[model samples]
Target: MRAIKFNILLILIILNFSAIAQIKVTSNTFYFGTIINIEKFAGKDYRYSLELKSTETDSLKKIVIQTRQVINKDKMLDANATKDSVKDTLWHQINVSNKINLKAKEMWLYATFEGNGNFFADNLKFEVKTEDGNWKEVPIKNADFEKHDKNPLKGFLTSAKIPDGTTISLQPRTDAVKGKALLIKSTKAAIIWKTNYGSNRRTGKYCNVNGIKIYYEIYGTGEPLLLLHGNGQSIVDFTKQIPTLAKHYQVIAVDSRAQGKSIDNKSNKLSYDIFAADMKVLLDSLHLKKVNILGWSDGGNTALIMAIKYPEYVGKLIVMGANLNPTENAVEKSMLNQLKKDFKMLQLKEDAESMQMARLLLMLSTEPNIKVEDLHKVNSKTLVLAGEKDVIKAEHTKLIASNIPQSELIIFKRETHMIPNENASLFNQTVLDFLNEADVKHP
Candidate 1:
């Protein structure tokens, strides 16, 4: 182990993996997430964090590296060697090649060791080179996926045993931003993490609902709450919302027929009404007469239909980004354009995923024809919601609310179609407020 100096332009970050050489770097510009230089070193495994301190004692902040990727593209033996020239190179740069946001203007970046992660720097010198990115200017595009000399990023790598609901992130940018971003690799080497609910993990038995095997999950113990995800999405979509809601209620999230873990044997053609009927049967199998329902996007359409057709099964209805009709007024112009673009992209590829996505998108163009009068028949207390910039038009969402007698409507400000994912806090609170405080009057 050799002793080294701490240097990063003007500001210095000193790390000590005892008996190992000091961590040194040539550049300080960080290149954000666009480039990650993982230099081979004669050092032990370490938890690293770059901390920024302010004049105030309580204002210190740090960015810790959560996920470390090791790529062996050519299956070279040198990569496995303990200490070799190629193995322990001066620096083997692994360019991130992904966009990472950096907010601080001028601050000291100090690399912290395990115990020293919380150390506050009093007056550490610092400098900003303003190198936003050089990787973006490179000739190669998506160098992570397609092998190219022009780009240095091999690809995203992850641990094999990432547990369920355990989101293995590269870094938690901010306290607020932590666990929000997920790395979905374009290629096969994706970060696959599932939520590990040891005792809570139960086998998803198939319910012969409408002859389609509807896969459902029941977590927690209380009043039943059926959670339905968006079009083409499965139970994974409700990953964030489930944990919180499950604590108070018996959360039943299902992988819709032909989506997620659910097998679809009943349909070649699909409609919201067809799906609504499936839900009614699933509830009957569980012997649940009435349950609270929350649905997003296409799931919302199904929920609306369920409440209208089988009012006995649904206690309260919460629908987001749902439309009564697949008309120009109901759907956004930009959404329609994006759908066309998606089809064009998938038309070139005949893969299962492409085919599946294309099929779902095609269904969005038609089906879901809930008449204005149909909403009046919905006996359950309904809460119609949509994002400010939702794929479904604002007028369309309000129209549903208007048609349903005594129903409430809410449009989340500055939010998109995936409000649950975008502004989860507000979305979750909105849901709990509606379901929990049923006795409280709405404004």
Candidate 2:
């Protein structure tokens, strides 16, 4: 009995030691946009080589290694075999079965010892590249002898650099699919342009508009053009188009209530009408009587409201992606559902009630409602701009054009909801031409 207990204790000690000997990694973090390199080795015998255990899921794919062995005093030893011989030396090529796109969130690397007998790895080191274009060395501290497991060794790597000077091809992450793609691409292109030309202005002066403090930015000098952004986006969303628009007209971009850099009222009494009224207050604060209004997406709706509600304050209206009829398109149902999902995802409870109110207002803006007859009341020269592939159907767009007696419609070919930003050249030219025509006809 005593001998058996002693043997059991000895086995436990051996098992504990063995368990502690397996290779383990402690630190793993990487930047999103960088490259990393890993190295493998075997103990003492420089003759030993390392083999990738599996072709699948290795972090480094398409590897090109210089494998000539170093010999004494400036001499190099080549692999013993030739292409024709049984022991021919050939550069090993392994196509990683799992081709990882650089954008992937994680990756792993594995190493194995290849030699005549069992060998251990001691002084393993690696070179890593960060997204910022820098190289770093990582040293492996401990490894022990064990039968090679069929499973590959793993490491966690990330880009060590920030995404700078890298242009991400914008694609939609939502299933409104075509419309979403157009919006994302246009927004991205606009952002790139804005980054190049606009001042990095972030803050805006806050003023009370009917008991709500609204945020606004003013840039350039000339006839003022009030700029309104889409729903769920801030005034900064116009970073792309502002510089170009500023060149020709004084651009006043504002953050609508409950979005962007603007503050939302807790009273939950907000709607697009309040937003249009807030614009009036902003204009009053600036002491401007009338200005050219350029609105995109939801902002376009606000521009229409402003033109109809306060005609004296709006010189002309250039509305893009504006839907006059809310109930006519199936897209509205999808948009409403997406809005609810987005609100839940963003944890925006305060904006929820306001969003519902805004939706009701949109529904009421069309026929059989009080605002239906008001379409003919718009005396301001209106340019209805729609993208070729906008979420708003072409029939609804035509209805808007026909109803707003003094309005003209321009359908941008191959464009989507973000017409002003996506087709800036065409949009700008169209607006300039319209403004010129309005000036000639009305002046």
- TM-score leader: 1
Against the reference, the lDDT scores of all candidates come to 0.56, 0.50
**1-443 in candidate 1: lDDT tens per residue?**
00111121112112221222122322111112212333322121222222232111121122222212222110111111011111221112211111122321111122221111122111111111224422222122232222323322223222212323222222222443233222211111222223532112343456877567787778888999999888877776785798789988898888876677666643267677778888888898899978999999999998998988998999988998999877889998877787777766766766565566666676777768888998899988888899888889998898899999968889988888877965787888888888986543332
Query: Model 2, 1-443: lDDT tens per residue?
Result: 22222222222222222212122211211111111222232111121122211112112112111222222111222322112101222222222222223323222222211111111122223334445645444443221112223311113121222123212122222222121110000111111111311123443477787666787777788999998887666665575677777787888888887665566636354456777889998999999978999888778888888888899899988887776545545145665565445544434334454454444333333321225577898888888878778877777777777889788887777787766655576677777778767432211
Q: In model 1, where do residues sit more than 4 Å from their true spots?
A: 1-32, 35-203, 265-267, 344-349, 438-443
Report the Cα lDDT for residue 421, model 1. Answer: 68
TM-score of 2: 0.52
Question: What is the lDDT for 372 in model 1?
Answer: 91
The total number of steric clashes, by the backbone 3 Å criterion, in model 1 comes to: 5
